[model samples]
Target: MEVTNLVVLPAVLAFFVLCLYFITKVVRLGKHPNLNLPPGRLGWPIVGETFDFMRTMNEGNVLRFIQERVEKYDARVFKTSMFGDPVVVFCGPAGNKFLFSNENKNVQVWWPSSVRKLLRLSLVNKVGDEAKMVRRLLMSFLNAETLRNYLPKMDSIAQRHIDTYWEGKEQVFVYPIVQLYTFELACCLFLSIEDSDHISKLSLKFDEFLKGMIGFPLNIPGTRFHRAMKAADAIRKEIRMILKKRKVDLEEKRASATQDLLSHMLVTSDPSGRFTTEMEIIDNILLLLFAGHDTSRSVLSLVMKYLGQLPHVFEHVLKEQLEISQGKEAGQLLQLEDVQKMKYSWNVASEVMRLSPPVSGAYREAKEDFTYADYNIPKGWKLHWNTGSSHKDPALFSNPETFDASRFEGAGPTPFSYVPFGGGPRMCLGQEFARLEILVFMHNIVKRFKWDLVIPDEKFKYDPMLEPVEGLAIRLHPSHF
Candidate 1:
């Protein structure tokens, strides 16, 4: 009996030792050794402060929730979790610099599960020299000569969209119309497709894909993921067909074919005298389509919302539009010079993006161990930046919450301060394209009609992008010459 008892006691002791080892490992994973995380209410196991954020959105006060945290917690850096990743969120000028700095090689962009599942591409992960090549190709396509060639196409599309879409609705659900129009415009320029019905159908499928980018990742029956996957597949197939036909058309009409961006991309070689592969072509097209459609829409919606709220700003824009319309440039294709001259309008758009950036938060996973704010950020840990919070940081912008276009009057915001287009080597490739599209739409719309909000004093909310949650309800008053 004594021998049996001794044996059983040893087995029990061994089991306890193994359990203790696991507990230590878990603790280490959960806590950073040197980083002093900002103070905040980290609620419930696993959930953290996610519930608080969702509640803020639910109550239509997301900005207030973020501000409350910044006021209460340490400003330079903070910690939170979403979808189980413990993210280190950076705010203030210092935090912004740290996030945008080069010392951290581990830094990478993070995408929400829905976006990841839908787009299946990320600048933070899949990007490399391929992106640089694509960027060069785009630069060539938007140059002085190229822009001149694109003018007729741009004017025709803009005029057609205005005449067809705006002529119908008294007060339109403006966001969807803007999205559809931009997608069509992009398709026409890049794909060289002039069929409106086909383009509209493609845009709807793409919209489904975008919506799927924000939902839970279960691709089963009655799931957003499933629908998004189906939509994405359809878009991919449709694009494949479009590209295939374009290639054949280019082959047949090699000399006489239109000089759109895609044709240029197909013919032009990189410095190495090598052409992009089929996959590269498709990927770049997808990137352009995604970037062109959504980001431009976001800008237009903000312009419309703010114009509705502030009548003086609207008047200024209208006056500029009228001046351009009455000039020799009136009803003519918008020139690169024309857009450059609208400096105030540009500043207004820039300020709106600064105050109400569409993408509120970003995350970069460290590829290597790095240091920031005097803390050792471990490899595999995500370094996140909250653009909404960063935009509102008093250190970055004076009177941060107020909409003041004059802030961009003399020079742009500090590189780190105004990152609506993102900064560094990875800045948006479609920046020029988006700017031109937006300027064209604004110029035409302001010239045609005067706009005001349905409720003169309605507050706007930020959901991914700052938009009037109840839709941009506006009454259109005919402009008097």
Candidate 2:
């Protein structure tokens, strides 16, 4: 054709590049051992879906968006690339069961650098050795017995915040307050930090930490990740100081006077009578403060927002609190026995969790090729299971969108079907702690005030945590206290 060599070479190069791209897609599919994975759209390229995904991150109905993907594509597990990393969204009962298993151990929890860098933990998998030890320690602090011991503290904190902060307020943004209350409780019961001002600043720092968690990982001055890392440093220093103080107090035989989680960790020794090191103490404190406060605050905000709308439920909550408080002293500490009696409140809280999970999506990197139904999940592919999306699935819950609290009245289904705190070995460590906090907060608030929505100009929206992005605004009138 008498074509110039240069023109021919460039055309050949373009053809090869296109060929390599599709060839790689085919190779990825073939790499999976099983070919029976659930069906899904491959689209123009494996990575093209990412831009649309990021665009949808903070827009529209998340539940419907994910649902449509599964339904339209007949996809139980679909692969796409995000930020140059291949990701698969696993859906349906079988896909969820397979992905949820810690036994497979292939799927690594892919926490962002904002959290990982801040906490100095691995960005992927197994949490960190320090973080792991702290998780174990938290079991002791957040266990049933410890929660029982802390009931008085929970009640007192709830009462104090309600009376002092919320008593005279009409409409208020409750998210910040919930966060503050949870941090204060974490300080008293977990970190043993007693100074209100110190705890308040720490709480604000924690909020900043959470804000930075989902962003791209870089420490540029203006980036959220940088601020998060700085926040983490602050928290680490505070933990060190508190630990030193606790050590001093213990040597002085003032241990009897301290009853927080840090105190327990300080006093309790392993089977060999060896004490946990300073790093261990600091790591656990950071873990507990993050898990205990952020998750609880998010859940409580959702619960209160729904409670305000349902006057019938609100009335019953007040009645329930009254019945439980009949014989208790005004300033008495609450016990597991006290929380146990508030069955209705527990159910309400559970329902709220079902409807609005704090941690919306759980992301894991597939360690190896895995198969479910007709779909094949390739190794190293990031897998995201939207628990919030699952919560609203009609297949999983009847009348899924309606705010009905009756679903949890019965014995409940298999744990994975309704996992508000997640499932498997990594299920939330502070679940019981959160339940107690929710019960205490709800009990006191219902007894003291009748809250009404300020009536949004438009429908409210959810942030990453299922908290209202616009902030929870509501009016509260004293309920004949």
lDDT of 2 by residue, 34-93 (tens): 555555544445344545664455552455556777777766566555533556777655
The lDDT leader among the candidates is: 2
**Per-residue CA lDDT of candidate 1, range 29-144, in tens?**
66765555454444544445666765665454565666776677745566666544556677755676666665335576566556665555423235457656666777777555
Displacement of the residue 196 alpha carbon in candidate 1, Å: 1.6
lDDT by candidate, in order shown: 0.68, 0.70
| Whole-model alpha-carbon lDDT for candidate 1 | 0.68
The runs of at least 3 residues in candidate 2 whose Cα sits more than 4 Å from the true structure, single-residue gaps closed, are: 1-57, 104-108, 122-134, 256-258, 267-276, 329-331, 456-463
Point out the worst 10-residue segment of candidate 2 by lDDT.
Answer: 121-130
Q: At residue 244, what lDDT does model 2 achieve? A: 89
RMSD for all candidates, in order, please: 8.3, 7.3
Error of 2 at 137 (Å): 2.9
TM-score of each: 0.85, 0.85
